[model samples]
Target: MKPASTMRPVRTAEAATTSLFHRLFPVNRDIAIKSIFGVWGAYFVFVTSRFLYVAQGNVDALFVQRILMTSICITSTWLLYRLLIAVRGRGMKSAIFMLTLPTVVLANYIAILDQIVFDHEAVVFDFSYLLKAVDFASFDWAYVLDEAFTRYFIFAGWGALYLALSHSQDAQRMMAHSRQLERVNRESELRALRYQLNPHFVFNALNSVSSLIIDRQNQQAEKMVDDLADYMRAVLTGGAQDMITVEQEIAQQVRYLEIERMRFPERLRYSVDIDQATKDWSIPSLIIQPLIENAIKFGVSGSDQPINITISAQSEGDRMRISVANDGRVIEPTARADDRSTGTGTGLTNVQDRLRTLYGQNASLLLANSKDGMATATIILPDPSQIFQDI
Candidate 1:
């Protein structure tokens, strides 16, 4: 699963990128249906107008016949649309075979309609008189054959056009979604980077565990060891999955902060005020880890007083607002513009990029000093009800 999941996108993206036609006419069913209606509707109007102008008021019968003929053609071709949808994703050979049968039926339908409505020069020699003993008026074999010979091409052409639109739209959408998932996977790989895997931090944790065991605080040492193991496992598991519930995310963060608390028990304090309503909401896994990491690394490192970090999730209108705020540092908004001032700016940028990739304009990440003088990074994303249905 890991090898295929990790490498399949590289091949799929490469194939999908070569499709310039799909890019220009992206996959949209509504647009495709509108174009079909627009073209057929225009053809109907043009034929009716031509009959009216050429014959004037003397040929009202011809105008009515033209409407009937256009209606038959439109109905037959709409059946083709339904057929195309039913046989979609079959290979071109199968699709073409499926389409050819309907075009033959459509041509026959139109040819029969012509026999009923109009008396053309061809009707005189339209196999009706040749086979006087048979019902040639109802089934003009020659005229039907002639219509099939000429008008079969039109339905065939429409079939091919529909196929192109169907497959192109699927390909283009698949490509877009595949690229976003690949981006998500790449970001997830950075989950265990920086201070989480720093050698000094690992050493400090081990030494602290050993000191607790030496002082016969075996329960504290055991709990710290468990927390350390659980935290690493949680963050490292980010690669394969992109989304989890808000409740699950907060649980993982709690493990992480518990481990950190062992490291700076007196200096670092944290709390979670997640709304009960938001526990079921979907969020990108480890999406909030960056904010927490930044708060601890910058906020805890720079401050002498005990820094209180608060993580909160609130339901605000049509969005779910989540924030990680710390009272230690009041970050100047302009300071973020200088990459050097914020050390490794990877955390904030990673959160921002993930938000954009996952939710586009519907999601946002902001870093600023709050009214209480706490440095906060707030993420605003679509409410679960709105976004989850599509997912």
Candidate 2:
């Protein structure tokens, strides 16, 4: 006896094979009946035409008899094909054997019917003549061989056509399934990148509120709490989408800046220079907020004089270029070992990862020192309308 564990895999494989067979050659009654009728109809027309040609356009009793006999042979051949499909289930070896075996038997049966029913000269039908007609000693073995080979090739051709159609349908179904899986994976990765931005922004905003409370600025702390509340609500609501219009994103950023301006009213100055044409363009939600937050933390916080932070966007052919710049101090190209700003490096890294996830290598975020003693963060993204059209 085989072990149960070993038996299970064999049974599973058999079941899967059976399922594939049914998918390839479905045996629905309506479809089978329609196919059989259509095939036999075509066969009837061809046989009738051949008989008319041989008889020289004569419509006589012998012609009618030959037509009826050929009809019976065609119906029998179709029935045999259906039976093979039912009993053998499309296994290549079994189907070939069963389909071919019937051809020889059916051809011999049709030959006997033709000889007895159509070639007889008797005015009255007689069983004695029919019996002698089918006798093995009198039968033409050569004729039977010719008929069998003809029918065998015809059925083989039919099987080849059926298999070709079945394979084509299977290929189409597999391709559709593969595309669906790719789409699902892309959506999942985009959601993960979108979620990463919220917590990082929240942590820094909350820290600023704590600082205000510690410095005994109660009025400013209360107002910052309100602004933070509004900002959190906007972020949470927009988090459900992978991208939003540039106008909406800038509004959220302005709310965030409102909270920061309260913390450094005297030393922080900011401006936005977005083109009117680019206002309705779409961008990854909260994509630029972290860059602005980084500017306030490192640029304004490290400076004694009033520092102006600027956010601007413009279209350059196929790409949208956005920059956030501050005049507080030049940012070092790399982080130092002991550097501890409000956002060490998490904010910038989060933005870079989100850009890569959304646009592969087409979008980018870069940080560099400007010619006028300011730190600038620039981002380039594909056009918003084109992105929407692609989706």
Residue 319 error, candidate 1, Å: 0.9
Task: Report how far residue 193 has shifted in candidate 2, in Å.
Answer: 1.5
Q: How would you encode candidate 2's per-residue C-alpha lDDT over 275-299 as one tens digit per residue?
A: 8877878898888877887787677
lDDT of each: 0.72, 0.70
lDDT of 1 by residue, 1-391 (tens): 5688889898888778757535533444565556566666777787677754575443555555566667777777767776766665677777888767767877776776666555442332233432344355556678767867656776777777777776777889899898778766655543433224434446777998998999999999999998888777666655455578889988988887888787688899999999988988888888888788778877876677788999999987677989999985556545765767455566677677666655656788887887887988899989644431223
Which residue pairs collide in model 1, if any?
27-169
Task: State candidate 2's TM-score.
Answer: 0.65
Candidate 2 Cα deviation (angstroms), residue 192: 1.8
Q: Which candidate is the best by lDDT?
A: 1
Error of 2 at 34 (Å): 8.8
Name the regions of candidate 1 deviating beyond 4 angstroms.
1-219, 238-240, 332-342, 385-391
Looking at candidate 2, what is the lDDT of residue 280? 79
